[model samples]
Target: MDKLKPFPAVPSDGKIETIPFLKACRSVVKLLETFGPVLMPAVDDIHGNVKKLEKIYMENQTEFKYLNGMLLEEKRKMGCHARIALLWLRRGLELFFVLFSKVVEQHAAGKVLQDLRPLIKQAYEETLEKFHGYRTKQMCMGLMEKFRKYKDFLQIMGANDERSESSVFTILPVYLDGIKCSTEAIYNRMVKKNQVEKHIDDAETEKTLTQRELDKIKVEELQMLQTEEKKASQDQCI
Candidate 1:
């Protein structure tokens, strides 16, 4: 939880460290702010879940060394607080991460539309639509009616200058991939492969990105933007 805003690194056991897991989630809640106030409801829910888990973890530090461990123990003891808390937290992270990834992808392609409801709707459908009850889903759609301009959003994400903007975007996907990995590691332990496939297309989303694939994405995005900028510059020159 420093200036780097690093995602929690899952330990070698692939079990999420309790304190770090909570910190990482708080980081995601912070990221949600860049989207503007339209997502305040989601931001609130995610932040609340983090607090829920943190409170329970604080109850017994040694007992809850790892998040997955806490859930497994709850299952064994036939209790549900930790289980339910983590479940909601995981679900919230998936919804937001999926949405953020799509936003970054659109921006990488050199397009950030003035109205982004379509993107918002798509993310909602993919992640949280089926899970929510009718009223919740309706509220979600209503929120989609508004969105922040991309330039202003990027400014909040710390795009102070040309060089810094590039740095911000580069760091974004890496953070996304890190969250993707940590969350998946926790989820894959509990959910079946088929269940995961239902969330993201294996071929499209890669299930998990290797460092090489991550680098490829960054390179491709930068090359695409650079090419577009150069072409526009040439046209203006002509």
Candidate 2:
């Protein structure tokens, strides 16, 4: 626990170094390992997604040096897996941050671990609830029922003492900021690159789409039509 380092602040250029960011995530996984069976799923998700990003970095260390660069390169190559991994990884980090921030809030208010179980549930609702299917959400709630005892839990996380608590309290805010900044930087880049996939609702779909969205939809529809026409022309010769 003492060796666990908080993620470094985003660099001056706002480019998160891939290796360093992944190293910080490794620390996140190490800490979550303290939660036993309750967080094993999250542990697995983080480990898996980290590997996805790490694989790309290993394949092209220089080109994939920064997170945004990796996203752009992968997206340019139509390699969507790394981008998807990033989406889930960001969500998992968000969940971890929310849960720990809530715990810190409760602790500051003189609350103990017994009082934190519901807070943990609330954190899930705030972070990962929307993304999780009904069954997975239920499984998460069920696992909450087996949460460990207060002192035992604290001991595992090294939060039992004033010094350790202070360490977390001091580090949590900056860590949260780092995650938000880095993820946001990459997400914005994806959107600018037209790599973000989102559904736009129109009166046709019984949903409302903005003017920009309406134009974007028309462009995509035209592109699809062109593709089909090209394919039909090729089939005629065969």
Candidate 3:
């Protein structure tokens, strides 16, 4: 390496050498120059494809909304109890869209996982809407729990190498499909009047289990308070 002569005024010392540095820079420039012809065409093709997809999505937006409204109308036709689950589903979908838009915006600006965590968390939190009846609340839980899986998906997406770009290509379809499937299943269970008695029995069983869970928690809390009081007494004696 010492045998190579750097240009005049360039450092000959091992710590600094101009010749190899210039050669490396020239190599990088040449590589890009060679790649330019192939790369530009590919980039243009990708841009065109993206524009087409955007156009299609725009065209379908109205149709999507109409279909969604029809589903809600169907739920409404099913009566009051079904409407309980419907309300949560509507709110959850609204929150998901807003959060997803933010995620897409951040991704478009080339943000990474750190920037995305909060948007995902906000979506998850917002989906947990309040409901009155135990059946309604359970239905809400079932609906939101499906959305909560997206939080886990973000962790998996972080592991993927393509975090810097819009996962819209993958994420959107998966989200839509999951929400659709869950909505259908919940709707079928909640709206079918024939299953009302079965649902009530199931709800009663669930209520009993939930009450038992609350009792256990209270027992544990009471014991913890007693232990603290006993410790205080022992400290005073000491």
Candidate 1 at residue 60, lDDT? 78
- In model 1, residue pairs whose N, Cα or C atoms come closer than 3 Å (at least 3 residues apart or on different chains), thus clashing, are none
RMSD versus native structure for model 3: 26.7
32: Cα error in model 1, Å: 1.9
lDDT, residue 152, candidate 2? 68
Q: Tens digit of lDDT per residue, candidate 3, span 138-218? A: 453444333323333454334244452245335554444443443344345332322322223222343455555545534
Better of 1 and 2 by lDDT: 2
Candidate 1 per-residue C-alpha lDDT over 165-204 given as tens digits, one digit per residue, 9 for 90 to 100: 7888788888888878776776665433113223333222
Q: Which 10-residue window in model 1 sums to the lowest lDDT?
A: 193-202
Candidates' RMSD to native: 17.2, 10.3, 26.7
* Between candidates 1 and 3, the lDDT winner: 1
Look at candidate 2 and tell me the lDDT of residue 223: 61
For 130-236, candidate 2 gives per-residue lDDT tens digits of 76667777888998777676666567767788888677667666666776776666566543234333431111231245567655654664464467568889999
Candidate 1: list runs displaced more than 4 Å: 1-4, 34-36, 191-238
Assess the local accuracy of residue 175 in candidate 2 as a C-alpha lDDT between 0 and 100.
Answer: 68
Better TM-score candidate (2, 3): 2
lDDT by candidate, in order shown: 0.66, 0.67, 0.37
Write down the worst ten-residue block by lDDT for model 2. 198-207
